[model samples]
Target: MSEALRRDYRVCEEIGRGRFGVVHRCYSPESGESFAVKSIDKRLISEDSVDRQCLYNEVKVMNLLTPNPNVVQIFNVYEDDIQLHIVLELCNASDLFERVTNRVFSESEAVAVMLPLMEAIAHCHSHGVAHRDIKPDNILFDEWNRLKLADFGSAECFREGELMSGVVGTPYYVAPEVVAGSEYCEKVDVWSAGVILYIMLAGIPPFYGDSATEIFEAVLRANLRFPPRVFHSVSPVAKDLLRKMLCKDVSRRFTAEQVLRHPWMTSGGETGSVAVLT
Candidate 1:
């Protein structure tokens, strides 16, 4: 742990661990509040390596997007010769991945989760930041049960009309355009959010395979289907929204803002009079 971090906060037991570091539950004596400190071992990473760049990028992106309720807030950063410690809001509840694996969510429950998620994504897009990696693992819940989007290791900044390239997301949630290695926009995050929605309702990813290559192939095919067995109870409005989100043609895909306005979302999972887009 960084001495500066230790001087400022009471770092406690490990709460979680990730690729480059471990997250510890910490307390700020000044505010009488608890937080998380993600400590990264600098010795394990090279100065000029992609891993080091990603660490810096995550901090930059999070700094740009903080103060939004749905997005995890970064409070402080501490660095020393051996480690880098980031102080962040502590979210005690399990992440979306653990929640989804435990049980499928009803449309109403799904709406509750997706609403904040879309809000976060919309906020990111409006600020010209693309959260290239938006998956269940990165969606956390605070003690108040508010959904908080975490992790920005793959985030990038972009202009409104310009396109970005380089595939940079997980297999199951990657957008079709990304799988095709074609230039894409912030809408790629929307596609990943759509996959999360599908998994929340159906308890399985819409696209699946035994390997990364196979998964990429499936994503490129973009053959979206709702197995009657799992989706029989799902609402048509929700299904329509999914189709719009997971559309292979990026032109037809729903933007984060558009998704927020969709009837399925606006109505709190209840059916509304708005005509479904084809």
Candidate 2:
């Protein structure tokens, strides 16, 4: 723990460790409150301009989206010679992946996840910020089990008519346009959301391969398949929403706002509408 961080908050335990750095469960002795403090090594980021820019962008975007309930909140940022400490709302509860990984999510269950997820993304898009990375691992559940979006390290801000070109995103959740090296917009995130929904309902990714290279190739082709055994029990409305979200054509992909009003997303108690996956 950095001495600067320790002065204000008592570091209780190490909660997470990743390629970037460490996340500790901390408490502010002054306020008697607990929070998660993510400390990233400055040298690790300063080595690459893109990495440094991403770190700064993450802080900017998260701060902008702070008012949204479904988005994680960043309370403060502290820096030292060797590290940058970001104080964030700690979700001691399990993440989406850990919560439902091996289980099948019924239409209602899928809605429970997608509705809030889309609402958060819609909020981001309306504010001209694109959460370039969206996946199960980035979604966290609090003590009440309400889902919240986290990890904005890859997020970018853009104007209404602007286009961004970058091959940034996890291989399994990447949009086709991104893999094709085409200038894309916020819709790329919708593609990733579709992949997440697919994983939730089918218990697997729609496009999968043995390696990252193969997965990237599959995403480029955009040949999404819905095996009957896996998708047989999923609702038609749910599948329809997924098809629109995962559309190979960026123009055809459903916007986050549209996704919020989608039938599968709105029809709360009607979980019996099954999709015919041929």
Clashes of each: 0, 1
Error of 1 at 189 (Å): 0.4
Task: State which candidate has the highest lDDT.
Answer: 1
Q: What is the C-alpha RMSD of each candidate to the true structure, in Å?
A: 2.5, 2.3
Candidate 2 residue lDDT tens string, 25-89 = 99999999889999998877665688888888899999998978999999989987889899999
Candidate 1 stretches greater than 4 Å from native: 272-278
Q: How do the predictions measure up, each by TM-score? A: 0.96, 0.94
Give per-residue lDDT, candidate 2, residue 102: 83
Q: Write the per-residue lDDT of candidate 1 for residues 158-234, one digit (tens) a residue.
A: 99899999989999999989988899999999999999999999999999999999999999999999999998788
Alpha-carbon shift of residue 20 in model 2 (angstroms): 3.0
Clashing pairs in 1: none
Q: Model 2: which residue pairs collide?
A: 236-275
Per-model CA lDDT versus the true structure? 0.92, 0.87
